[model samples]
Target: MTRSVALFATCLGDQLWPEVVEATVAVLERAGCRVTFDPAQTCCAQPAFNSGYHDEAKAVARAFVEVFERADAVVAPSGSCTAMVHRYPELFRDEPDWRARAEAVAHKAFELSAFLVRELGVVDLGARLSARVAWHDACHALRELGVHDEPRRLLRAVAGLELVELRTGESCCGFGGTFAVKFPELSTAMLDHKLSGLDDRVDVLSAVDSSCLMQMRGRLQRQGSRVRAMHLAEILASR
Candidate 1:
């Protein structure tokens, strides 16, 4: 049976790394999913939620649940945004009615890697790519979703893909949505520490969140480093 999945392209995803969103659609189709995208869907409201704007965040998150509440399964290439969806129920604590809706939608929501490996029992995508790759934990994906091994399992199955372990693979890239904006200096410092582990052994740095990739990629480009930052979906969709 083909699972009909609603693709939740996070706000940053559609704007910054549109190619990654395209890659996600291609990958899900290969995994036997009938993918649907609702352009009416908007932000997950993570930035506002994280920045202590509960009322504004709730408004946006309410719209989000309204769009995806009917989905059989909603998958996003972003761990950060998916993590925010998991917290939607809490965002509507006082409203029992909306909270119930949020809970149902959150339960069906999944990060890309976890959906493929754990839910779908798919580890390999028959992808071919020759390059040394490192997986970044993308904070929310690791701590919130407990998605540590799923991405690695899928990447290891890719032919000619050398999955290397970075010394600080699990560290934050300092791109915590608005967290990077509020403290630019501290953010750059944390990002520098995160990228200090990169070397010639790894050509591509892949993570489940595009926000983290954008943060690191900007620093790498400014420093004239050839290290490429890619979303996990892009690598998985490769052939």
Candidate 2:
């Protein structure tokens, strides 16, 4: 049986890193899943939700629920956004019907790595990327979603890929959506601490969240470091 999966392209993944979405599609298709993309999809309203705009967040969450209610599974390349989708029920708590729909949608959604490993029982994708890469755990994916070992397991299965330990791999990249913008100095300080922990040995830094990759990549670029930041989907899609 071919599982039907919907691609929930987060705002960041759709705008800043379409390659991540493309890679996600590639990985899903390679896993024997039928993938669908909806043009009507927009932001998961994580920004509004995080910034204390509950009504606006609820509106967007309702749209998301309507858009992806039918897929057997909804997979996103971003962990933070997936985590946000899981909060739709909270956004629509006062309304029983909408809350039920939101809860159902949340139950169907999964981060790409989690869907592949947990749902499809797939560990190896025959991906080949020869580089000393360190995997950074996106905070929401690690703590909120409990997606610690799945990504590493998939990475380890990639042929010729060397998964190195980043000293600050578990630390936040300081890209808490609005949190970074509201407190720039603190965010930068946290980012600097993260960067300082990186040794001179890694060639690529990979994470499940594009937002984190963007935060760390900007700093690495400013410092002119050779380490490249990439999404795990892109890495896993490599053949």
Candidate 3:
């Protein structure tokens, strides 16, 4: 049976980097899943939720559940946003009916790498990127989704791609949504700490979440580092 998966292009994926969304679809299709997208999608409301606005976050999450509950499975390029979906049930924990719906929908959500590797049981999509790449673990993807090896496994399968450990691979990139805006100095300090670990051998620093890439990319560009920050989907979608 062909898997029908919906792509949740979170706000960043939609406006900031549509290419990541496109790349995600390309990779999913190559892995034999029929992908669908709903234009009704919007922010997963992580910002409001993280800031402790449950009522506001609940309002947004209700719409998100409405849009995606019917999908047989949901896949997104971002582990952070996918992690937000995992919170819907908790966001509505007081209401059993909404919680039930949220639980059902959240159960279907999957991060791209995890879905590609664990759900589909397929690897080696014939992706070829001749570069020394190191994977950066997006905070929510690592601590929330437990997605440590799936991305590495997929990257290792790519032809001519060398997967290396990013010394600060597990540390937060400090792009906690609005966290950076409110604490610019602290965010930069954390970003500096994360970047300090990237050595000269790496050609690209890959990560599942574009937000983290954007955080690192800004710093990398400002400092004139040659190591390109790329979304893992973009790297995997390469031929």
> Taking the tens digit of each residue's C-alpha lDDT, what string does model 2 give over 179-226?
888999999999998877777888899999999999999989998999
Note the Cα lDDT for every prediction shown: 0.92, 0.91, 0.93
Model 3: per-residue Cα lDDT over 1-239, one tens digit each: 67999999889999999999999999999999999999999989889999999999999999999999999998999999999999888889899999999999999999999999999998889999999998899989989999999999999999999999978758888889898999999999999999888888999999999999999999999999999999999999999
Q: Name the runs in model 2 displaced over 4 angstroms.
A: none
**Residue 61 error for model 3, in Å?**
0.4
**Backbone atom clashes (below 3 Å) for every candidate:** 0, 0, 0
Candidate 1: give the clashing pairs. Answer: none
Query: RMSD of candidate 2 to the true fold?
Result: 0.9
**Candidate closer to the true structure by lDDT (higher is better), 1 or 2:** 1
Q: Compared with the true structure, what per-residue lDDT tens digits does model 1 show for residues 92-129?
A: 99999999999999999999999999889999999989
Q: Distance from true position, residue 169, model 1, in Å?
A: 3.6
Error of 2 at 181 (Å): 1.4
Give the 10-residue window scoring lowest on summed lDDT in candidate 1. Answer: 168-177
Candidate 2 C-alpha error for residue 129, in Å = 0.5
